[model samples]
Target: MRQPALITFAVLCLPFLLHSVAARAQPEPQSTGSDSDIAITDFSKPSSPGRTFAARTVINAPVQKLCGILLDYPEYPAFMPNTDNASVIQAADDFAIVNMTLKLPLGKIKKYRLRLEPRNTPQTCHLSWKQVPWEDLKADDTIADTSGYWHLVPHPANPARTVVDYFVYADPGYVPFGFRWIVDILSKESLPKTLESLRARAAELP
Candidate 1:
């Protein structure tokens, strides 16, 4: 009887162990743990092959308020830092195609177009995107590739608050091999400021 219960317990715990292993295998960038407001993490290594980041914040605003901010695709540069321009090429109630030009720290301009899909529920919305080849440049001309999602989850206990999460992966295409460190440094240095700016902007919204 004892042996059977022990085996059953072990079997029940396997999935959790696997989850911990997987999380450790792809360790998120280290950061100060969050309390209730905002926390951010970004992978920044001089020799790393790609850039990835995730940010989480609590905003004292409703989901629809942030939904409007995100879907106003053409005005992204007005509030999103380092973005020089954004244009919505096609649009619908639930999706859009957008083009963006990014002014890199080294001053190279990278342009890419992406498809965005918005999924909304009663109190939450998720906006996700992936890069697509555009006419002005080949797939290799801009940053190599990118994909990400922004999720707004209403706080379970606080009806007036929402938890916002942004996750992104970016690969630089035209970046010079020797100077990739510049990109790494900039990504790390800029992410916190970007999150702060977003928090400030959202807080200002009605």
Candidate 2:
């Protein structure tokens, strides 16, 4: 009788122990953490062939507000860091072709055309863009290739706030030996500033 009682007690406690272990293994919740915190993962290292960087941050604004700011491509230069000019070349309801000029370090400028698409679901809003070649426009210099996406979803613990995920990769092809840092900055260092700019812009909204 005593042995059977001990075995039953051990079985009862096993479930709770397993549950605690699983909960500890889960990722930290953004809502419960600092709102100003930005998490970045760099995958552009030589060992990682992906050549991309990913970042995550929590914004105080809702997804709808952020969506409006992102979809307004023509106004990007006003708020987007390093953007010198942006214009909509062609547009449809769901997609648009936009030409952007970026002011890089040391007076370097890159002009590129991008095709952007907006997507909305019940739970998330997504904006994705990739570089596209344009024949009719003249540019001082064009970047080799660039692509990225922004994912905005309602916070699980707070629907009024948003969780943002940024993914991007850029290839500035054939840089001088002295200017190699430019590639590093474009692919990695500039991520935090880009995300922070969007957060600040959304906060300015009414």
Give the TM-score of each candidate.
0.75, 0.78
Give the true-structure RMSD of model 2.
Answer: 6.8
- What RMSD does each model have against the real structure? 4.0, 6.8
lDDT (CA) per prediction: 0.74, 0.83
Q: Cα RMSD (Å) between model 1 and the true structure?
A: 4.0
Q: Per-residue lDDT of 1-206 in model 2, one digit per residue for the tens?
A: 69999999999999999999998773332332575588877656676433578888888988998988999998899788789999998999999999998898899888889999998887789999999997764444876788989999998999889999888978876677798777777678778888899988998879
- CA shift of 137, model 2, Å: 7.0
Model 2 residue 110 CA deviation (Å) reads: 0.4
lDDT tens readout by residue for model 1, 62-151: 777877788788877877877889999899987889999877665666688999999989888899999887877865447777788888
Regions more than 4 Å wrong, model 2? 1-35, 45-50, 136-140
TM-score quality measure for candidate 2: 0.78
lDDT of 1 at 105: 62
Which residue pairs of candidate 2 clash? Answer: none
Worst 10 residues of 2 by lDDT: 26-35
Which stretches of model 1 miss by more than 4 angstroms? 1-37, 42-48, 138-141, 185-190
